[model samples]
Target: MSRLDVTTSVPVFTRPLRSTCRGVPASEAPPLSSAASLVGQQVGHFRLLRELGRGSLGVVLLAEHALIQKRVAIQVLHAHVTQDPARVARFLQAARTLTLIQDAHIVSLYDLGMRDGRPFLIMEYLEGQSLAAFAKGPLAPALVVDLLTQVCDALGAAHAHGIAHGSLNPTSIFLVPDAKGRQHVKLLDFGIAGLLPPSEGAADSPVAADLFAVGVLGALLVTGRLPSRGHAAEEPLHGHAWEVPPLPSDLRSALSRVLLKAMARRPVDRYASAAGLRDALHASVALDGGAAPPESLGLERLPGWYALRGPPGVAPASR
Candidate 1:
């Protein structure tokens, strides 16, 4: 069980500050202030409760509906970020893209509005740790496959809508427990990554890039390490190549082949779609004594597994 060093270039949004707002339209509100002042304030039909986390671009607040009392997460853009009209346009476009996608494995959007000239998004609040927290060591083969399958289902739904996640890292993959205490996947920050400038030498097609990320995640879970690190260089494949290590001894060789194909540097060499990767996983499971029974998967046995109540006294992390 070696430790995994997961990293991502994806931009993250979290934190809190304060500002004031009345009935002023988002376009008419004055220059923004710290979001911390927003606690106990009203934004749209929800009241800000407390700060969950803040990022370079925005702040995430735990909010509750005034009437229904239903709790939700609210993400508000920072004043500096709002100053760029192009950035603001991208943010609004991302929101629209999110509305077009509806899947249980992906976080749900409830509403979109403005607060003191800053754009805000109302989203479903989830209670669970991210996949990043549990990636400290190699996970059980069954658990890895289960998680991969769920993520594939989510990406499949998004792809069908002609959208790409853009950012598919461990932190974006949330794990919420059901009434049966089974950990289910819920993807966060779907189109937000498109808001940032494209990285140099980045993948040409967002869809192909997403599949590549899925392969990276798969390799990390199986080996507790990224395939791109600490290996001898080899001839590049399709102008790029990652030095993937062999799968653990306990895993079937067929599983190794599946991961390799998914990770192929050439977009054309990889699985055509998320569905293709998922079907490969299913076939591998069928050949290896059937998928492990859900009850026997034992995700609760992981080092930092959390229940629906979540860790005591700890506020849930921002999405």
Candidate 2:
């Protein structure tokens, strides 16, 4: 048998940082499309709670460490997907890579191993809302800066480790409220994390893949817009898509210039690094704040920083 080599400009190192995640199905596969029954089962040392979400790689269930009582999000692979030896190897590789990453903003992986012929991961259970779950609307520029600043920290950490979150969608960015009642942003998902030495990448480079997406994410979150990243040499997006809605004209202009540059088609044209992008955000916030970002999210002025209306679908969970 032959192995399928990952054909990319960058090459990822396959090594284990912790217990690798491996999966393989038994003679017969269980029914999928429906949640696997483990709502009351014990996985490793964690007790399964309920299903929170699902993705191409696995289903994420909210769980709690039996002894520590710490909350966690568990990702369990589908039995069928794990049947192939190569897929099992890839899943293990991904788990190892994710474990090596120690980013506060990135969802933390507490543990990972095989169970019930499926691979599973015990991760930091975050109380936050995905950028996907929210409707982009008016937000205080300063608040935007704060959230993006946190994202920059996580991205910077990942970049330092040579990991580029292969898929950085709006849902990847989660906003959880802190004890102080302020929103804290967390970057999630590393299933397709490109932690490799690549020869070529999205738009001709590796580092730029996530940077481009981050810019688009910024635009989408700040304004209800889509594909902030520009089109090909043929046509460009100018006041098209959902961006045509009514917004403070100046606010529109500011995001336009900033996000446009970040989403430049060429990697060289985008922010050099996540840190650079963060700096750009800082500068933009300063400029936009010709007036201060409202005291908080669209709320009337308050005496101090506020507990802003979170992105939709994220009502603060009582602690």
Provide the TM-score for each candidate, comma-separated: 0.77, 0.69
lDDT (Cα, tens digit) per residue for candidate 1, span 1-319: 0011223111122211112111324653323366678788776556888877665567777877777786767677778777877778777776766566667676545666665557776666655555665455666566777788898888888888777777666566766656655567767766556555564445547777777777767776777653232221111111134444567766666677787888776878888888888889878787776755765563444443221222221011111
lDDT of 1: 0.61
lDDT of each: 0.61, 0.52
Clashes of each: 13, 10
Off by over 4 Å in 2: 1-34, 193-201, 226-248, 252-255, 290-308, 311-319
Considering summed lDDT, which 10 consecutive residues are worst modelled in model 2?
Answer: 1-10
Per-residue lDDT of 85 in model 1: 78
